[model samples]
Structures are given as structure tokens and as C-alpha cells.
Target chain A: MIVTVTPNAALDVTYTVDSLVPDAVHRARDVRRRAGGKGVNVARVLHALGADVRAVVTAGGATGAEFAADLGAAGLPADLVPIDGETRRTTTVLSAVDGSVTLLNEPGPELSAAEWALLAERVRRREPEVLVCSGSLPPGAPPDGYARLLAGRTSVLDTSGAALLPGLAGRPAVVKPNLEELREVTGLDDPIAAAAELRKAGAGAVVVSLGADGLLAVTAAGTWHATPSKVLTGNSTGAGDAVVAALALGLCRREPWPEILRRAVALSGAAVLGPLAGDVDLAHYHRELAAVRVRPEGES
Target chain B: MIVTVTPNAALDVTYTVDSLVPDAVHRARDVRRRAGGKGVNVARVLHALGADVRAVVTAGGATGAEFAADLGAAGLPADLVPIDGETRRTTTVLSAVDGSVTLLNEPGPELSAAEWALLAERVRRREPEVLVCSGSLPPGAPPDGYARLLAGRTSVLDTSGAALLPGLAGRPAVVKPNLEELREVTGLDDPIAAAAELRKAGAGAVVVSLGADGLLAVTAAGTWHATPSKVLTGNSTGAGDAVVAALALGLCRREPWPEILRRAVALSGAAVLGPLAGDVDLAHYHRELAAVRVRPEGES
Candidate 1:
């Protein structure tokens, strides 16, 4: 089964408020709770795409129970490793009037050495077809700890920070970062130049996601750039996760570069229009995929 | 003893983030959990004011446990009536960058008939000198619910909506509402006119809080207005509760009308700068109270 690992996951809560005022009382109009984290986000999108995937995550306390309850409510495949402190609760406040979103993320419960070891052992036991480690490292976790688990697997590293740099030391199937993150990672502003730097720096392949513009991929075969059919406007909360989800599925199916890039762009575009983060409009995504265009980086 | 009846108390969780981007992930710099609800706030603030107060409220499940835990951590007196569903949690996302606050309020767990009876019985048994029924009315509770229980005692009503209307109909010793809420209750924009309407409508006495402008009290003796020595700039999350807290304490001591109003305004002004809603800066409040001035409404 397709597997995803989220070292730290959370109970995601979204609130709708009439207005937000500084240090004042506000009456919330509505609220929705779900399970969230980068890797968990990727797995959710994959599940939405009708892909059978197993999610491996760490949680603790009543908040962990909240995560499990939310995941169970969604019918997602979960292999949650219980720990000590309560799992964190991440809040998203959606101001519908102005379409402004505020995120209040809790640093998830800290993981002990024993819990981390148990997680790694659990991953070792499940020979997942494709292992995607996405998002930030939780507190108490070593930066490259996620990458070390990719030793015998075809892992996709899609996180930023000291973690991403160290993870790149061990070449993974692909590492997807946006233009800004690419600039931060390789100190190159131009997409082509940045992709080149990543390839040279040891990444097996580099897929640089450019919001609104689309995605660019560089590999041994060559380079390709793909753009969505239309610039759809909506929340872009989980667009990157959608791209990662499609990229992993495409890798598993051995889809050609052009098809993979086109599909990923459409999926991300659909995700931008979804109300929930990491959720894509399947019909719209499928319809838009056929219209996505991929041009060979217009170079040799 | 000061008795606070929080029929609809809550567990307040505050998450502070750098910026709030709706439906996106945010990293909270601080997370503070505390016991909340109007009555609970009154209990806490009153306790801080040297009044021995017992928080008599209902609770259930983990949410209730956490609510009780917060009270325990603060070293406040409490008598939590156990029930079925988990207590509700009120989440506030405070943006660290701008200090903007957003609230996500949950409809608290429904209390069974047995639970309601138990609460009423508890109030009947204690009969503290001054009783405060503040905040929202819990679900499954009738509108006149609290008023019926605190029947003969000198009760102060600090609430709005159906609960406030019914409590007023029962002739509570004192009722306090901000100018706007007083308007909502009396359908008049004028504070004095609104307070007069309430006094005529079965309310024993009416205290209409006008922020910055000050506090106006209408009683059998006469109507008087008390203004703080200085208007300080700060949040007013629990300013009204602080007023009620000061009132509860002053009334228990049988302080004169304008003196009660003076003390209430000073405490409320100090509360504007306090961390927790309804909390007052003890030193500031005391110092400011000494200089608080009360003016006759007209030949009082």
C-alpha cells in the first residue's frame, strides 16, 4: 500500500468568525475539525484520489484521541503510534468576508527517543511502495531523522529547512519545493537555475512548484514545465500537498514526465478551489488535467 | 462568601500565531488554557479582589476535566457538578503580529435534567451572601433557571438574551449590562433611559456600563454616574465581569451606591490591562479606586 509518514500530526480545527479584532471577544459562526499534518495531508489527497494508502503518524493524550477520532470519521487508513503528551491542535480561522485565513498551529507533542525508534521500526516493517515524508520536523526530532528512514525505500522528500538540506544528502526519488524554498535551498532565484543546482547537489529529481505559474521538473531525462488550464482563484492552503500526492501516484504508476507534470498541475489547481486544505475537486481536476499543457523546458 | 454560578462555563484555549492565514497551517508561539465563562470569570476576579468565592459550575468528560484543571492550577475555589458530555472548549486565535483575536466557540455539552436539578440544589444548600449568575445560559436550561435557584438570596444578574430577560423579570438585586446590551434589552439607545427602563421593569437596581465614559447606576435612592480617574487604553475582554466582581464584593459589604459604582469602574479600568479577561491589576485597581469620582445624576 502507498504509505505516508507524519512524525507529528494534529487535530485540525477551522473556525469561521464574523470579524477579528485585536484582544477582543469574537463570536465564531461555525467550526470544523479534521486530522492534519503535511504527510497526513498528502495521504488524504491520495485517499481522495481513490488511492489506497496507509498513514503512519505519532500522537498523544486527548488531542491524539481527537486526531484518531477525526481520522476515523474520515475513514482514512491510519497506523497511529501513541505517545505521552497530548497531540497538538492546529486552528485555521477563515474570514469569509475578506477571504483572510489565520493559522494558529501548536507545536505537536514532543516525541521521546523510544517513540521515535518505535516509529522508525514500524516504518521498516511496512515495505511501502512509495514513502512520502512531507512538512516540518516536530520538536525533539533530529532534522534528518525522516530521511534516514528512506534507506531502503523510494522516498519523496518534500519539506523545508535543515531537514531538507540533510535529506538531500541522501538522494531521494524527488524533492518538491516552491520557487522561494528553492531559492532558500540552493541560493538560486531563477527556477531553471535552481532546479539545476538541486540536481547537481544530489537530488535524484527536482520538481519546483511555482504557485499560479505551475510546476517545473528536472531529471536525468531532461527538463519539463507544465501549467494548469486556468488560473483558478480560491484558497491555496494545500495546493502543494495535492502536487505531492499526484507526483507520488505518478511515480508509482511509472507515468511519463509529461503526463505526470500535467496531472500534478491540474490536481493542484483543483485543490486551490477546495474549501478544505489538501482536498481536490475530483471532477474538476480530471476535466482540467486534459487541458494542462507541458512544454519541454524549451531547451535541450 | 461570594458565590458564582456559571451555568455555561467553558475551557478557553488561546493560540497565538505570527499571522493568521485562513485554512493554512500556522505556528502558534503561545498556547494558554484557562477556565472561562462569565460566572467563572467573576469567580476568579472576585477571588483576586480578596473575596472568598466558590465557583459552582457543571462539567463533564475531558473538556470538563481540563476546565477543572485550569481552575485548580489558578488555585481558585470550585465545585464542578459532574455530568455526561464533555464540556465545551472556546478557542481563540490571537495573531502575534497584530494581536488580532478570533474566537471559535463550541455549543457546550447538553446537561441532563438531573444535572440541572443538582446544580439548583447545590445553590439552595449554600446560600452565600452575594450570588452572581453570569455568562450565557447552558443548553437544556430554562431561561429563568438560575433566577429560580438563587430565589431568596441577594443575586446579581450579569448576562443577556433570554436568560437576562427572564432573570430581570424575577427581580434580581442588581443587573449590569454594557450600554449596547442594555439597549438590546430596553430597545433604547440612551444608557440612562435604558437603565430607567430596566429599573421600571422589575429590576431592583440597574448598572449600565459605558466604556471609557464610565458606569451609571440607578437605584431606589437615586441615579448616579461614576467615572474612572483616568481612561487607560487596553483590551476590554472581561471589563464587565470585573465590574460585577467588584460589585459582588462591595454589595456583600453594603457599600453605598456611588461608592460601589466608583470601585466597580476602577476595578474594570484596571481589568482592561489584565492578562485574563475580567482580571484586574490589584495594585492599579486599588490606587485608582482612591481617586474614582461619582457625580449625582441629578440632585441625588
Candidate 2:
């Protein structure tokens, strides 16, 4: 079973209005809420694909309760670690007219050292065949929190900045970073050199997401570039998580490296076609898979 | 004891940000929450003034649970009626640099027919000396809901539009309508004639609130105008609720028309000086009371 840990899980709320007028009163036409975080999105997508998945999350206070309740209502399994601090809520205002989305993200509640230890222990006990540690570290947590979770597991790490540096040393099976994140961590303008440098730091493989340009997969076996036939334009919030889910599934099923990259690219494209985070149409995923083009680049 | 009925209660959330740019991402510096609605605010202010008060509110689902928990945390007494619909949450984004507050209000949940009767039954059981029915009606509720609640009681009705028209026929002890609401309901530009017309429709008295200019109280006994020495402004969201609270107290105390108007005007100004809804500084109230000006505006 796939197990994911979202230490900074959130209750994501989206308010859809006719149009958003700044510095004025806005009455929302529709409001949608979901249990969210990077790892949570991965688990949700995996579950949508009919895979057995469990999400280990830290939740507290009223917002935390709402998050847990939302997960239950959606039929997503979660092992929640109760804390004293209230969980944060991320709000997105979507304009129904033009489809412009504005986000308001709150800094997550700080976790006590003891609470961090408790969360680490819970993730370890889950015994994931393919573990996914995702999202930023909450305040008061050490940067190595995700690194510790990746210790004796074949994990996919999706995080950036302070959290990514220490986590790279733990040798995760895959590290997914966007173009900007790759530049920030390695301080290198060249994407190929940055991925190679990240691999040298002990990441098993590096998947560099290039947005509309597709993905660059660097592994010890070989390097390959994969791209969809055409760009799909829509909400891109959960595209990375969908990619991670495909990679984890391929790793668990012992699929070929080239096939894994193809599936990941297809799933990422399919996720973009959907509206909400973690929402992907399986039919769209299969259709995109046939149109994906994968070519092996020169050996690393 | 003053009893307030907030048919549409809310979980009020405030986010303080450095600056809000239009259609761009904002990272909030602080977040605050409370249980709120017109009647709830009136009850809170009355409680802060050491008046015996009880608030009857409708709450449901996860948001409702949080609203009730917040009320309990604040030590505010409330009688909550459980319903199937989830209570709404109102968000206010306050700019730390300029003190600009942008409000986003959700249309409240639709109530079942049985839930409406339950709420009416609960309010009647409270045996309030001065019943206060305030705020908008939830979806699926009859416009005459407040009129039914004001039956066989000396009540202060504070609402607008369709709800206010039906409630005015119930002969509430006092009906408070701001300038805009008066114009919308009566379609009269003249405040004096509009207020007089409201009285003729079976209202015991009429209190016309002219924001910044102050209040005009017209009763069968006499007519009086009351105004604070200066227009104190910070957050004016709860100023009307404060006026309703003072009016309820005065009715219970059997105060004269001029005295009641004077206290209402002072409390309204003091509420504006405070930062949040229902959070009037008693010291500010006392100071404003001394400077309040009241004059007989010729008998009606």
C-alpha cells in the first residue's frame, strides 16, 4: 500500500465568485473545501486510481477537525496525529468569468519538538511500500524532518528550500523539484547540471518538472526527456503530486525507468485537464499516455 | 435578561496581511476567529456591560461546531439549536499597513422546515424580558420568521428589506433601520417621513440610524435626536449591533426617549472605536457617554 505523510496538512477552501473586485465586499457564488497538502494530494490521486493508500497527517484545533472530517467525507483514509496548535487554512478565490485564481496561504502552526517526534514515529509505523514525504516543514520543525522519515524507505521527496537540502542527503528514491526550485537549491542556471548535482548529493533520481515544456528525468541507469503531444491549459496545482504518484506506483510495480517517466508525464498532463487539486480523469490519463513521446538523452 | 436570536450565525475569520494586491497571492501575518452575527454581537456587548444576556443561535455541521466552540471559549453564554445545514463563515482581510478591511460574506445555509420551527420554539422558551431578533434570514426560511418570534413580547427588530417589512407589522418595541435600509424599504429619501411611515405600519417606535450623522428616535411619547461629540472610527461593522444592545437595555430599564437615544448613540460611537465586533471598550463607552448630545426634535 502507498503511504504518504503531510506534516503541514491544510483545509483548502476555494471561493468562486462572478468576479473578484479588490478592496471591496465579495459574495461568493460557490465555496468548495478539501483536505489538502502535497502528500495528501498524492494519496488522493492514488486512491482515485483504485490503489490502496493511507495518509499520515498532523491535525489540531477546529480547523484540524474540519480537515479530518473533510477527508472522511471524501472516503480518504488518514491516520491523524493530534496536536495543540490549530491547523492552517489555505484560501483560493476563483473568478468564474475569467478563471483567474488568487491564493491566500497562511503560515502553518508551529509544532513542538515532542509533536514532531510523534509524527515521525507514526510515519515509520505505517510501513509504506512506497512512502511519499511532501510539502514544506511547519514552523519549529527541524529542516531534516522529511529526511528522517525517508531514512530506511524507498521514498519520493517533494519539497523545496530549507527542507529540500537536508532531505536530499537521506537518499530518497526520487526527488521532484520544479525549475525554480532546482535553481534555488543548486544555484545553477543549467537544469542538467542541477539534477546531476542533486543526484551526487544522494537522491536516487531527480525529476525536474518544466511546466509546459514537460519533464526531465535523470537516473543512474540513463537520462530521458518526456513531453506530452500538446500543452493542456487548466489548473496546475496538483500536477506535481500526480507525477509523484505515478513514479511511486511504477517503483512499487518494478516498471522500467522509461515507462515510469511516460506514465508520470501522462498523469501530470491529465491532472492539468481537471479543475481541482488531486482531481484527475482516468480516461484523460489513458488518452494522454498514447500521445506521450519519450526519447533517451545522452548518458549521465 | 436580554435574549437575542441570531437565525443566521457565522464563524467570523479575520486575516491580517502586510498589503493586499488585486488578483495576487497574499501571505497572512495573523489570523483571528470568533462566533458572530447581529444578535450574537448584541448579546456579547450586553454581556461585556455586565448585563444578564443569552443568545439563541442556529449552528450545524463542522463550521457550526467551531462557531459554538468559539463562543464557549469566549465565555459567552449561548443556546445553540442543531440543524442539518452548515453555518456560514465570513472572512475579513485587514491590511496592516492601511487598516483597510475587505469583507467576503457567504450566503447562509438553507434551513429545513422543521429546523425553522425548532428555532422559534427555542426562542419562545427563553422568556426574555427584551427579545432581539436581528440579522438576515437564512435561505428557505419564511420572510415572516422574525414577525413570528416578536409575538407576545417587547422586542427590538434589527433587519432590512423583505424581512423588516413583515417584522414591522408585528409591532416590535423598536425597529432600527439605517439610512440606506430605510430608503430601500420605504422608497422615501426623507428620513423623517420614512421613520413616521414605519411607525404607522404598527411599529411601537422607529430608530433611524444616520451613520456619521448619528441617530433619530421617534416614539409616540416624543422625538429626539442624539449624536456623539465626534465621529469615532476604526471598525464600524458592529456599531449597529451596539446601538440595538443599548436600545434593548433602555427598554428594559424603562428609560425616557431622550435617555435611551443618548445611551444608544454613545455605545454606537464606542463600538466604532473598538477593533472587533462586540468588543467595545467600557472605558471608551463611559467617555463617549459624557460627550453625547441629545435634544428634543419637536414632538411627533
Candidate 3:
């Protein structure tokens, strides 16, 4: 089983409004709330694809209860570590008029040293074949939070900034960072250079998600660039999580690097077609998979 | 004892940001949540002033639990009727850059017929000396929800549209509507004419809140206009609720019409000086009370 760890889980709320106007009052036409976080989304995608996956998350207060309930209702396997601080929420306001989206993210609750240890212990107890660590660390958490969970185990690390560099110490099997995150960490605009920097730092393989441009992979086997034939238009919030899910699945199944890259690109494109993050159209995924093109980095 | 009824209660959330720009993502600098509804505000004000007040509100799901916890923390006396539908939340985004405020209100959950009856039964069991009905009725709720609660009891009614006109049939001791609501319900531009129309519709007295201009009251005692001597600037979201609170207090104390009008205007102004609804600066209230001006309508 693949175990996904979400250090900072959130209750994602979506408010649909007629139009979004700054400095004005709006009455939401509809409100939808669900469990969300990078690792949670990754696990959701894996579960939807009928993969063996379990999510480990930190939960607290009323919002946490709601998040846990939603996860249970979705029939996603999860282990929740209780904490004192209330869980945070990420609100998305979708404007019906122009289909524009505005996001307001609350910095999640600070985890005490004891709380962090508890969460780490929970993940360790699971003893899964593959461990996927995703999302931001709450305030006061050790920067090497994901690295602490690695313990020389096979892992996929997806995070940014301070948390990103420290996790390299554990030498995760795959490190996935979006293009912007790669530039921020490596101070390199070129995807090839940035991916190389992460691989050198300790990553067995580095995958740089390039949004609609697709995925660029730098692995021990070889460097390859994968792209979907058609650009899909929809919410791109969970596209990266989908890519991480695909990569984890590929690693678990021992797929070749080229095949893994192709699946990652196809899954990422399909995620964009979903209205919310961590969701994808199965039919779209299959169609895109056949059309995905994977070639060596130097190829035209 | 004054019993304040909030048919549609909310978890009011405020998010403070550096600036508010449409179609852009924001990371909230601060977040504050509290129990809210027009009646809840009125009850809070009364409790703060050391008056005997109990808030009757409908609550359900996770949001309701949070709301109830907030009320308990605030030490406000309340009766929460349990329901299956989750409580709604009203989010206010405050921009630190320009002090511009934006509001997003979720339409609260619809009440089942059984739930509505239970709520009414709970209120009737309290046998309050003075009943105060405030805020909008939830979807599927009876239009005359406030009227049904009035069983020849001394009451103060503050609502709009269909709810406003129907409550008058129960002959509430006072009906308070802001200028905009007055026009919508009575279709009259002149506050004096509209106030009179409401009295004719069976309201014992009609008080029309005119924002910075203060209040216009038409009663069996006399016609009067009251205004604060000087304008106070702050958030005006809960100013009307403050006016209703003062009116309920005055009625409970058997105060004269002129004295009550003066207090209402002063309280309303004081509420504006507060950062949040149901909050008042005691110093500001005392100062404004002494400076409030009240006169017969003809003199004005």
C-alpha cells in the first residue's frame, strides 16, 4: 500500500457567486466543502484509480471533524492524528459570470513538537511500501518534517521552499516540484538545470511539472520530456497532485521511466478537466494517455 | 427578560488581508470567527449592557458547533435548537490597504417543518417578557415566522420584505426597518409616510433607521426624529442591530418615546465606532448618548 502524509490538512470550501466584485457584498449561490491538502488530493486520485492507498493527516477542532467526515463519506482510507489547534480552511470563490476563481488560503494551525511527533509516528506505524509526503508544513514544525518520515524508505516528496531543501537529506525516491517552485529552490529558469540540481542534492529522480506544457523528468535511467497532445481547459488546482499520484503508482508497479512520464503527463492533463482538485474524468484520462508523447530531453 | 430570536443564525468570519483584488489569490493575515445573526447581535449587546437577555437560534452540523462554542466563550446566554442542516457562514474580507470591506454571505440551510415547529416551541416555553425577532427567515420557512411567535406578547420586530409586512399583523410593540427596507416594503420614499403605513398595517410603532441621519419613529405617543449630535465613523454593519437592542431595553424599562429614541440613536452611533457587529465602545456610547438630539417631527 502507498501511504500519503498530509502535514497540514484543510477543509476546502467553494463559494459560487454570480459575479466577483472587489469591495462589494455577494450572496453565494452554492457552497461546497470537502477535505483537501496536497497529500490528501494525491491519495484521493490514487483511490479513484483503484490503487492501494491510505492517507495520514493531522486533524483538530470542528473543521477537522468536518474534514474527517468528508474523507470517510468519500470512502477514502485515512488515519487522523488529533491535535489541539483548529484545522485551517482554504476558500475558493468561483464567479459564474466570467468563470474566474479567487482563492483565500488560511495559514494552517501551528503543530507543537509533540503533535508533529505524533503525526510522524502514525505514518511510521503504517509501514507502507511507498510513502508520499505533500503540502506545506504548519508553523513551528521542523523544516525537515518530510525527511523525518523518510527513514531510508522509498518516498515521493512534493513540497516547496524551506521544507523542500531539507527533505533532500532523506534522499526520497522522487521529488516533484512545479516549474515555479523549481526556479525558486534552484534559482534556475531552465527546467533541465533545476531538475539536475534536485537530483544532485539527493533525489533519485526529479519531476518538474510544467502546467499545460506537461512534465520534465530527470531520473537515473535518462532525462525525458513528456507532453499531452491537447491542452485541456478547466480548474488546474489539483493537476500537480494528479502527477504525483501517477508517479507514485508508476514507481510501485516498477514501470519504466518513459512509461511513468507519459502517465504523469496524461493524468495531469485530465486533472485540469475536473471542477475541483483531486478529481479527474476517467474517460478523459484514457483518451489523453494514448495521445501523450514522451521523448528524450534532447529530442525535437 | 428580553428573548432575541435568530431564525437564520450564522458563523460570521472576518479575514484581514493587505489588499483585496478581484480574481487574485490572497493569504489572510488574520481570521476571526464568532456567532452572529441580527438577533444574536441584539442579544450580545443586551448581555454586555447587563440586561436580562437570552438568544434563541437554530444551529446544526460543524459550523453550528463552532458557533455555539463561540457563544459559550463570550458568556452569552443562548438556546440552540438542533437541526440536520448545517449553519451558514458570512465572510467579511477587510482590506488593510484602503480599509475597503467586502462581504460574502451564504444562504443558510432550509429548515424542515418539524424543525421549525420545535424552534417555535422552544421560544414559547421560555415565556419571555419581551420578544425580539430579528434577521431573515431561512428558505422554506413560513413568511410569518415572527408573527407565529407573537402570541399577544410585547415584542420588537426587525426584518424585511415578506417577513416585515406579516409580523405587523401580530401587532408587535415596535417594527424597525432601515430606509432601503422601508421603500421595498411600503414603496414610499418619505420615511414619515412609510412609518405611518407600517403603523396602519398593525405595528404599534414604526421606527425607520436612516443610517448616519439616525432614526425616524412614528408612535401612538407622538412622531419624533432622533440623530446623533456628531457622526462617528467605523463599521456600520451592526449599527441597526444596536438600535434594536436599545429599543428592546427601553421597552423593557418602560422608558418614554423621546428618551428611547435618543438612546437608540446614541447606541447606533456607538456601534458604528466598533470594529465588529454586536460590539460597542462603552466610552463612545456614554459620550454619544449625552450629545444625541431628539425632537418632535414637526419641529424638525
Candidate 4:
């Protein structure tokens, strides 16, 4: 069973409008909510891929109920810790014409130490085969909470900044950082150099996603690069989560690292073809996987 | 005593964010909910102005509970009819810097005939001093339902479209339409011409709320133009509703037409400061009343 922990979970809402006019009244045509956090996103994707997963997070008030509804609707089993403050909500406004998305993010309710302890207890109760920690650390939480959550085992850590810095000390099985985050973490202009620096900072292996450009890796299997195959994009909301799921699967199944990168790229491409988040077609994934290019070091 | 009826009330939720992104994840920084609908706004403003006011509406489920809580918090009495469906929610997204608002309106649950019957029964029992009907006709309801709910010599009908057409035929004491809607109803671009046409159509009197411009009225006394002292602008979510509340109050007290529009403009100006619909500052309203200007015109 895969266990994903979202320390700062949110009820995500999306609004569809013709155009956003600042300081003007706009009538939104649509509103949608989903339980979100990096860990929750990873668990949902893995579950869609036929993996047994448990989504754990803390919540409160009506916003909390919304989070549960979102998870239940997505077919993910969830265990949530209750709190006094209402759970936070995230709003996204999508353009009705081209589907361009804008995001407004909230810092979220501050969690008490008791709540953190409660979440840790919930985690201990449901021992997951593979543990995934996602999103930022909520304020008041110790920086090393992610490392402690994994208990030094081979875990998949998908995060950046404060959590990423301290979380890297635990040396998770593999760390997945997007290209920008990799640069932010390592202060390097080059993606390859960033991945190497992150690996040096105690991340056992690093898979830095480069979006449309593809994937880069640095691990025991050696440095390698895989470019994504051409696939029509529909929505990219959960494609990154899909890549994380594919990478975790590859490590757990002990598949070859290069093949894992190939699969990750294909799965993400497949994800972009689906309408809503966490939706991917395995049929498309397999078809795209064969066309991926894996270039070894010094290939050029 | 002024009583306002909202057949389809809502828990208005406003989300404050930096920007909106579609299909992508965004977080909301602030969340606020209030009892909403045109009638509710009227009653809220009347209550703020020290008038004896009662708000009669239907509320249900958890959102309904929230609606009642907000009404209680605001120091207003709720003669709310309960329904099986939860009270509908209206979401508005506002940008903090720009003060721009976006509205996502939900067509509330269909009001069963039983619910409609219940609201009518409540009105009969109360027989308010000045009954004010506001807001759009919900689905599964006839526009003339407002006329069916209240029948008296002094009732005020402030509605549009179907509600306006049928309720006007019922010969309510007063009807308030903005200039644009007046054109749609009477096919007259001229205010005086439109007022005569509505009177011919059976309305006893008509008041045209011209927003920042001011109020135009054709009453039993004479034709009068009430112009506001200044445009103190901010958020104008419920300025019209505030004007309606003051109108109902004036008719109830039998205030001289001049004092009526003066107080109306003052109250309407105060409403411009509130973020939600129908909110007004009593102090602001009182301060501006002394400066309100009314000019009598040639009319019936």
C-alpha cells in the first residue's frame, strides 16, 4: 500500500470566466473543488494507475468536508485528522476560451503541534509500503518533519524550499523536483548541474522534470536524459503527479532507471490528454513510452 | 415595519485571491459568507438604518444553518422557511489590490410547491407593514408568485422581468426599476414617458434608481428628482437594495416625498462602502442625509 501525506491539504476550487478584469465583477460559469496537496495528488494518480494507496491529511470545518468529498469522488481512500480551524481553499480561474489557468494561493491554517502528533499517529497506524511527502511545510512545523515522517527509509520526497532543504538530509529513495525548483534548490543555471547538486545534498537520486522539454536524472544507475514524445495536451494539472507516481512505481518494482524515466515521461504525456486531474490513459501511456528517447552521457 | 421576502436566499461566499488560474491549482486567502438575495439586502439595510424590519426567506441544511447564524450575528430576525435542499451558495472572487469582484451564481434548488405554499402562509401570518418583494424568480416558480405572496394597498414590489410584469398587473403601491429596465418594460427612452406608461400599466407609483446619478419618482404627490450630494465610491454591492429599503421605510412612515428621497440617497450612498450586498453604515447614511438634494418636477 502506498501512503501519501499532505501536511497542508486544501479544498481546490476552479472558476471558469470569459476574462478576468481586476476590480470588476465577473460571473464565473463553473466552480470545481478537489482535495489537493502534493502527496494527495501523487496518491490519487497512483490509485488511478491501479495501485493501493491511502491519502492522509489534516482538515477542519466545511472546507474539510469538501476535501473528503473531493478525495471520495476521486476514488481515493482517505484518513483525515480534524482541527479547530477551517481547512484552507485554493481558487483557480480558467479562461472559458483557451483554458488558460491563473492561481491564487493561501498560506493555509496554522497547525498545532498536537495536530502534527495526531497526523503522525495516523501515519503509524497505516503503515504504507512506499511513503510520499509532498508540498511545503506548514508554519510552526520543524523543517525536518518530512525526514522524521519517513523514519530514514527509502521514501519518495516531492517538495522544495524549506522542506526540501531539511527533507533532503534524510536521503529519500528518490526526489522529484521540477526544473525551476531544482534550480531554486541548488542555485544553478543549468538543470544537469542542479540535479547533481541536489543528489550531493543527500537526495539519493534525483529526477528533475523539465515539463515539455522532458526529464533529467542523477543516480546510482548514472546520469541519463529522456526527452518526451509528442502528445496532444488537454490539461496539465496533474501531469507532474503522474510522473511522480511512475517514478515511485519504477523504484518499488525495481525496474531499470532509464526505463523508469521513459515510463514517467509517457505517463505524464498520457495525463495531459485527460480532462480532469489524476486521469490518464494507460493505452496512450504505453504507446507513447515506446517512442521516448533516452540519451546516455556524452551521447552528443 | 418593513418586511422583505427572498424566496431563494443564499450563503454568499467571497474568495480573495491574487489572481485566478483555470484548471490549475490556486489558493484563496480569505473566505466570507453572508445571507444574500435582493430582499435580504433590503432588510439588512433597513435594520442598519434603525427601522423595524423582518427578513422572511427559505433556508435549508448546513448552509441554511450558516445563513441563520449570519443573520443572528447581524442582529436581524429570520422568519426563514426551512427546505430539504441545502441553501444554495453564491461564490465571488475579489482581488485584494484591485477591489474587483467576480460572481459565480448558482441557480438554487427548485422550490417545491410546498415550500412556496409555506412562504405564502408565513406572509399571511405576519402581514408586515410594508411588504417588499425582491430578487429573481427561482425555477419552478411563476413570476406572479410575488403577487400571490402579498396582497395589500401599501405593499412595495421591486422586481424585474416576469416578476415585474405580473406583480405590476397586481397593482402594488410602488415599483422601482432602473432606467435600463424601464426601457425594456415600457419601450420609452424618456424617464417621464416611461413613468406614465408604467402607471397606465397599473402601478400606483414608480421610482427609477439611476445608480450614481440618483432617483427619479412619479408618485401620488408629484414627480420628483432626488440627486445625491456626491459620489463617495468604493464597493457598491447592494446600493440598489439600500435604496429599496429606504423607499419601503418612507412609504411606511408616510414621510414627505422630499425627505424620502433625501434619506434614500443618503442610505444608498452608505451602502457603497460594504463589500457584500445590502450592507450600509448607519453613521455614513445619517451624515450624508443633511446634504441630500431633491428637485420637484412637473408630473402626476
**TM (chain A) per model:** 0.94, 0.95, 0.96, 0.93
Q: Each candidate: what lDDT? A: 0.81, 0.87, 0.89, 0.79
- True contacts preserved, each candidate? 0.67, 0.70, 0.85, 0.61
Instruction: Give the per-residue Cα lDDT of candidate 3 at A293.
Output: 95
TM-score of 2: 0.81
Of models 1 and 2, which has the larger DockQ?
1
Q: Write the per-residue lDDT of candidate 3 for residues A68-144, one digit (tens) a residue.
A: 99999999999998989999998888888887778888988999999999988888898988999998889979988
Candidate 4's displacement at residue A173, Å, is 4.0
Count of clashing residue pairs in every prediction: 7, 0, 0, 14
Estimate, for each residue in B235-266, the C-alpha lDDT of model 1 and write its tens digit. Answer: 46678898998888888999889889888998
Interface RMSD of each: 3.3, 1.6, 0.9, 4.0
Per-residue lDDT of B175-292 in model 2, one digit per residue for the tens?
Answer: 9999889999999998889999999987899999988888988889888888889977567778899999999999999998888888898899888777788888788889878888
How many clashes show up in model 2? 0
Candidate 3 docking: what grade? medium
Considering lDDT, which of the candidate structures 1 and 4 is the better prediction for this target? 1
Which candidate has the top score in TM-score?
A: 1
Model 2, A1-300: lDDT tens per residue? 889999989988888887776556677888888888888989988999888899999999878988999899989988998989998888878777876667777889999999999988887787889899998899989888888888878989999988998998778999999999999999999888999999999899999999887889999888889888898876677889999999889888888888998899999988887777888878889988888888887532
What lDDT would candidate 2 get against the real structure? 0.87
lDDT score for residue B211 of model 1 = 85
Could you give the TM-score of chain B for each candidate, in order?
0.92, 0.95, 0.96, 0.91
